[model samples]
Target: MTPKVSIIVPCFNHAKYLNECVESVRNQSYTNWECIIVDDGSTDDTEAVSRTLESDRIRYIHQENRGLSGARNTGIKNASGEYILPLDADDTLNPLALEKMIAVLDQDPDTLIVFSDTVTFGHTSKKSNLQEKFTLKELLLGNKLYCTSLFPKKYFDEGIVYDEKLRHGFEDWEFWIQLISTHRKQPITKIDYPVFNYRSHPETSMIKEITGNTDKKEFIYHAVYEKHKALFHEFFPSYISLLNRKTFYEKKLESIYSSKPYRIYNFLINLFR
Candidate 1:
């Protein structure tokens, strides 16, 4: 029988965390799932480590280092299950996440995306962020969907593919916007439990993109802002008003040397650092 869900993990130079991610999925309380690890041309031992898994349910695909969006699209293309769960290489899902999410999907056939709260862990700290039912405006302004959330596989086939051109950030935000706009009526629900553990590390792509380097941040900042401004304004006009007081793009270009350029400089710096 076809697996009920397909877990697609995109890996790039994260050999250290890939095994733990796989172990989390393998230990899932639910059994009817397939794990697809798309090795996005990692110049590390990621591929070799994934090959060590002996389960027939595990399928490994290797591709050139396409950005996160490209790697996710590849996973969508190769998925054979009815549901798709995209997991970050450095993150792991709670053992009961699939079980709970699947139960919800079964109860409501019209649901498109189901997400859960996440426990974010760094050096010596762990904190939980409760997932709330979000409006398109909230999502466009700030993405709350953790990477391990469950989504309908067909939603991907019908909605927009990840914008591979966005090499650094906001591709997920863009794609989610497209989904919300096109399939505006589909229901999105949030499970109460912390079903995802987001590992915080110095070498994560998002961290490296925002903090350690500033050259591409301007592009990413405006790229994300421009893409969602319309939707964001539709729901939260106040934010747009605040933003228009001074063009973020202009400030970004002018303050190339300023310690912090964006209003949410802390977030922008952390996402790319």
Candidate 2:
């Protein structure tokens, strides 16, 4: 029988953590799940690790190195389950995640996407708490609803796939924005409970142009500010409200950096990290 959910995990050079990630899914309290592990041209022993899985519900797909977005697109194209979920190779889901998500989705037939709160863990401590529902505008401005969380399989049937051109980052955010722009009102439900753990190693690094330097951060700040300024105007065509939103962000930036010493310090430190 076809499973109720397909869990797609794309891996590339993550053999060290692949076993644990796959095992977590296999051990899920929700029984009706098919684990699809796409090994995106891993140079490590990822294949051998997956081979160790004994469950027939687990399937492995091998493909060339195609970045995260491309890998996820491939998984979406091949998935057979009614509900689809993307899980990072480095992260592990709580056993009850699928149970909760499926229950919620079953209750609300209109929900196009269902996501739960996440606990982001460093090699040492956990980061901030998970945020609740975020509007399309909020998602476009800042990505609080992380991508690895659950999404409906029908979402892919509309030919909505990740942009492979975005190799480095923000591809998921871009996809969500496109969905909102096209559908006008896509129901994205948020559960307050933690269902996933995002693993963070000490040497973790993002390839975004603005992540590592003060000058680049300034550039990103302006670039994003300008982009969001345009988006705000699009959402609120009225000049007065658009002007107020723009002014709010500008003043908010100044207040956060100047008045909030710890915030500025963290922002600066994030540049090097």
Best by lDDT: 1
lDDT of candidates 1 onward, in order: 0.80, 0.75
Q: Which stretches of candidate 1 lie over 4 Å from their true place?
A: 122-124, 203-208, 211-218, 224-242, 246-273
Provide TM-scores for the models: 0.81, 0.79
Q: Candidate 2: where is the Cα deviation over 4 Å?
A: 207-210, 213-233, 236-273
For residues 152-193, write the lDDT of model 1, one tens digit per residue: 888788756788878877677677777777778889888876
Show the colliding residue pairs in model 2. none
What is candidate 2's local distance difference test score?
0.75
Q: For model 2, what is the error of residue 261's alpha carbon versus the real structure, in angstroms, after optimal superposition? A: 11
**Which candidate has the highest TM-score of all?**
1
TM-score, candidate number 1: 0.81
Task: Judge candidate 2 at residue 209 and give its lDDT.
Answer: 44
